[model samples]
Target: MDQSCDRTRNSLSQSPTPPLVGVETGPASEFTGKYMVLLRDGEMKEGLQAIKRVASLTSVCVAADYEGAAVRMDEAGKAEVFVLDKLGVAVVSADPPQLRRLQSAAAEGGAILAVEPERIMYAIEPARDRLAILDYLRGYRDAVNRLYDSLTGVPGEAEKELAALTAFTDNAEFTWGVQATRVNQSRFSGRGVRVAVLDTGFDLDHPDFVGRPVVSHSFVHVQTIEDVHDHGTHCIGTALGAQQLAGGVRRYGCAFGGDIYVGKVLSNQGSGADSAILAGINWAITNSCRVISMSLGARVQPGGAFSSIYENVAQRALTSNPGALIIAAAGNDSNRPIVIAPVSRPANCPSILAVAALDSNLGIARFSNGGINPNGGGVDVAGQGVSVFSSVPDSFPAWDQPGGPGRPWPPRYHTISGTSMATPHVAGIAAMWLEARGAGTTAQGLWQLLTGSAVRLLLPSRDVGAGLVQGPV
Candidate 1:
């Protein structure tokens, strides 16, 4: 390691104060008053010394000090610098003078790659009227199914079969998403592969996952890996739920045999800092999880730039030995036929697969974002998102069910709509592809396998990307 703090000290004596790395553009956006420092590959120790020398920081917490990048959050919260050792990135709390000095070190080109402010991210599902939208889309699907049945001849059994094949809907055996995506027909079960879902955590006590293999940890401060918000449970169910559920209702999951690594990055309130997310990713990559599903993001403006810190991390994760592919939600910030918001941050990064949502009709979801932004901000794939059926925590309260619309009673299973719901479908299918393509498959290979085999829709590439992701035959 470059233990020459004296060199940095000498350079600082002659050089002028450098500008801050990043500025907050919006008043509404929340920052943690900390900055993310991306270190050059294989220079982690050197980078730490440079940062500490430049910033005059005292306390530092390295993930290696703990087990499996699982730094004690309480201790980490008190440190001036917290390093995700495996990821080669640091979350730094610095004063103005210290920040300027650190920027100078980065400019001088020694170990430090880049520096940016850490922003808070949330579960990509919108907070308002989600159930109402699901109800409306369900009604729309039912109407379309009824119309198709009425148009078919009432005499022949073959005509009924054709109608069933053409107009897909949630049946007694499988979810509409599973049927539409052809997951029910795929021979691959994603066996032996590991899938990581980073979100609001998961329900360990959920009966559907009783015998399933699950490895879980929490990165959020003062929180457990247990899911209280219901988002993580839903996403995990879509990705790794069993082929046959406990209640023996509809089968909703795609990868029934893959290992589930649950990282509680977001809090029970459905929000988390960038540092926690990065830590979660580090944990996943360190554990060699082949497919990482992140159904969470921070919304960006029309021309917002993707985070270089996250981009570098994802790119390295893809190209590293036994690499992993990262999949994230494209966001639910748009109103179709009108305003179309750009893809969300982190997901907007080129190295991360950005997934958009599609309804049962194979049309883009009304709230699914588009690839309107420049650079790497584009939707890479589409997945079944609207009115998608999946599992939730058993403790989840019952909503408008029984006499009401199609919501499940007892609340063990629930149907919702978002790009959040769509991401895990793509992730679980990626697991299947990894298993089908062979054990030697890399992240780049998996990416090619997915985009190359996608079903091209009639919509523009910006909206549907390569189109709906398909499973291996």
Candidate 2:
């Protein structure tokens, strides 16, 4: 017998195929000729052997080296194989007959868990119109400053303290979501909690995070851990930035003392493959992180079910890590009063908490995704997202752009909108709750406590779920 044949036999003999859950059997319409096969955790070797076996049965060409891994390709580039061992998943492009055979092999081999179509994931933020938004915010800030100056009469240390407090409270950094959740009153600071933020990576040398404990990795092979795009850094800042900036100008973060785990799942372009996101989740679970924050997702049609791979991974992480919770953005694809988009993928997974975005007035953000599914996956909570301020990379050009004609340019501290901003607020708040609740609490229990404590609003459940997520009370 050939060596490859021997390996295939060994792989099939290892274990029996597990039941497929939440996975569609046939090829998806979006992925008519391609599918992704996910293996059980730590079973990459067996999975690869199974894949090779399936390829040998078809007319596919199996190449030993395709970007540091093996690939199976058919002519016309319509069929290809991407073996993502780090994610325990393999992406295969094949015709209907080939896909069915692969699925059959996967089911019999046991090493393959799910065979679903590949999906795209992206950072959940609106296209940057920050320059215009910054100008409007600057005007508002000037007005507030003028009011503050007019109100100050007594000149003393007490007056200065009051001034500082006013400035802090008035800024976008001190968003209404922060005030509404009452995080300021909580004594807990997520001191020992480890939070994994899976996004477009972070600025490793950001001055604000100088002394903080940060561990970072890059799943996007082309990019390093350094964040060229500011999305990841902004989200991390909201979740784990310092309590105060250098001059005590603002109070922007929630879990000030939480350990930061930055996973660059998305590339600098702010888009990523499903395999990369899954790999990031695996990394977070392996690292024993208490909270995994994903401000990224792929839009799915209404009534679409969650991905089995992500759902299973989230369930495992919850059971394995003490109080480990995965929080994700609901996405920024809605146009209220017109079109209302459903919660995005991964976030739509029941095991993951889906967070919506709310403005200062407590209304749902125009772009915040809704709970259209009505079954399992829906918006679980709300957070401040509109005109929200947080830390950004000092080198980001948007920060230096002049606000309109005469208005001052936005500072290193930045403000933006989207469910991307809201997600970290919830992640940081979850960290605070985890800290207050102490140990032995399960992820589901923390989720209940967080949702149960939410300040109910008048918005529909489809829009805000249990309402604004609260901090430790």
Candidate 3:
């Protein structure tokens, strides 16, 4: 396998240069004024030189010179070009005429591969009312557990005794999500695999993950890997939480044995830009992580085209040796029985896996986006999302408090819904499959096993591409 950045060096060698479309602009297309530039593999120096010449760029900032990919964007923003060396990509701030010059260079088969406007993205926010339904489900579940305990044994002892019987049942020992995916029955624990979760930073002090191996870095300018927002902590909990949990907390994660990689691409306010996301992807690939789970994306219009730069990067990741499979959330923009939105960006790229959300009854989530558009915008798989139980920062407020209680414990756990919650389930299960399939499996091979082995549902393929993803037996 070629180790150089020019994984697609042959893209221009044997063919005529494709017609250039330059940068797109309009009211519907929301982008930062800056542009993203893809450099041909192995021609980074030439690309930089071309950019300097075409755009008359005077200042440049290269990521290779920084520590932990923490390039000071404040300083970088002042430069005419900011280069992500590992990914062979750059963010350029230039005038429209200068951008046209770069496009002309690309059309002439120069080192510049592609140019597009940088996009704005966010951590997929669940529908405003989705959490209300999740809260109701949690209440019903607790009532059932309380009734079952009172009718059978001591108030709390039922959970401990029946924990052994939780393999296929949703109870106090295992979340409905764990039972739905059947991860509880799988023997593989994802040992020796590397799983990267890119979102808001994580709660490094969370007690549930006290002893786990974690490598964390932040691409968000000036932000550390510490998850100030609860979203990243919750997502990581579902993908890599401990199996042998203390305090009788139900099992929520899959791939408990996989090495954890945390990439903080989104900010504490649950928003981010394309440059941060691309940098995070580069860092994950550089580390050879086998699974890169992103629960963030920008909303796309019904017929919006996917980013060519992202598509190319994802393809290279799949083809590279010791490659990584990137999974992302389908947007939660639908109203169900009313309106259905297209899948979100980045995930809409053909090479990335788009994940939809499923409720406890194995029904498509009302807010889960679908395949309303063509060209790789379909939802590839479904996972448990409604009323999901997962870890959160200890200081985080519980989603539900007891009705007439004296005072419940400061629950270090939470239950929520969204495609954001669903994506990690697919990612964690992918890690388990990699462990089960053996060291010889490529990223493409893992993708095949995932969709091929999915439990087909009656839902339209648009809503659930191959149906729900399942753990390997």
Candidate 4:
């Protein structure tokens, strides 16, 4: 078998030959985006070669090497192509010069995509077969006094076993500080900021977000925003939900009045495929969702994954939308020496703001992912993640009973815990910063403020990241 296709043997196969590109549902008239049938890996080079045979297609460009790939990944003027690793998530190693340089530059700005070549197959395929394997591994995430054999697709649990995690218990003590840090000057409501929740769909009727117009798109099968799931809705509510029940007193989130974009990239199963994820990301970029909260990730992926796509998208969002934000959950299944892995593509994205989880005391969540070590590893900032409260679909298992197997049912809202819950906090803060700036800020500028305003904390013995995520200064 070709090493490229060796990534995973998927259990799900699309019929109708899976169009190379086009809307997954309904008529092609809904979208005008040109569609390209990206042949599976090994076929990419040949596919491009075949395209060269057609002289009728005048508008065409070809790239040869990694440099050419980096250059043509869209010329900073067209759509971006972010690739997930064969492992199904972001790349973890840093042996390749390109990836190393890209990760190194991440702390400074949001640009550069792709990483490591020897350790990672740069022209690799997105692995979806392994998602099911990884999501199942999370089942044993909380078992104490057990040494878990690292699975092929799941993450490490050393962090979770090592410590207890938490988040704000009430809103009172945190709100004043939230206001003081990023918006001590702004007195008006945060009515206009746009937050994109690119996880599972959100609870459209949750009281906290009742009137927040939810414009959403689904890449997962025929599912829509009306679908219910714990992870996606949880992250959505945290960022811009009017008020939360944490640390007491009714607390308005960092962006209490921001509008929302619910991008349902993942499915009701709490897991998703890399291709679907990439499509969702492209949609977010094209739609101009300024602050997107992605509380989902793949457990495994090659190092420096998706450089071309992320670089292009980040460039567009920064240049066009300015002040735009991408916040992602670090991962749960912590408390150990091994940190949980990141989602495909974004995990290694320079422009993305990766978030871990914290307990009420501001200690890193045992299950949250941390920063990369000097030798080459992941590094991430922590946020509150324990017993997080958020909206759930009407049919959420914890809140709703199954009428029958395979029966039609609507979704509802509920509470759950994971780094997914922590991500929205930082996203909300970014929106507040954007609102306060009044003028569009640079990606580097927004990152500086976010890191600067974050409250410092110690964890993982190496002091992995800056500290607790807070409003921008």
Which predicted model would earn the best lDDT? Answer: 1
Error of 4 at 467 (Å): 1.1
Q: Tens-digit lDDT track for model 1 on 199-238? A: 9899998888998878999998889998887789999999
How well does each candidate superpose onto the true structure, as a TM-score? 0.87, 0.75, 0.83, 0.58
Clash count, candidate 4: 53
lDDT of 2 at 34: 53
Q: After superposition, how far is residue 254 of candidate 4 from its true place, in Å?
A: 3.5
User: Which pairs, if any, clash in model 1?
Assistant: none
The candidate scoring highest on TM-score is: 1
* Model 2, TM vs. native: 0.75
lDDT of 3 at 308: 86
- Candidate RMSDs in Å, in order, are 12.4, 14.0, 12.8, 14.0
Q: How high is the lDDT of residue 45 in model 1?
A: 90
The per-residue C-alpha lDDT of model 2 at residue 473 equals: 59
* lDDT for each residue of candidate 4 in 1-473, tens digit (9 for 90 to 100): 01222222222222101001000111111211222222223344433333233212223333222221222222211322223221111212222443344444433332222222211111112223233234324433533223332222235554543333222343433432243233333453345777777776777766666656777766566576665544566566667766443223344355777778776766665445444554555556555566767765533332424444444445445545363566665444333446444333344355666666554445554455544423233544556654444444555442233333321222343223456666677787777777777546665577777777776554552333667666534
lDDT of each: 0.80, 0.69, 0.77, 0.46
Better of 1 and 2 by TM-score: 1
Model 2 poorest ten-residue lDDT run: 1-10
Q: Per-residue CA lDDT of candidate 2, range 1-473, in tens? A: 00010001011112111110011111222333456787777777777777767765332322223332212222212336555554466667667777777778767758877788766666733233433244335435644664566567435544443433332133535655567678777788888888999988998887778888788777786578788777789899889988766635467788998999998887786776675676566667666678899987776777788888778767766665364799998877676748898788888988899999876656676667888886567989998777666776666653434453221324455556678888999999988888898866778888887799987776799899898888895
State the weakest 10-residue window (summed lDDT) of model 3.
Answer: 1-10
Per-residue lDDT, model 4, residue 163, is 33
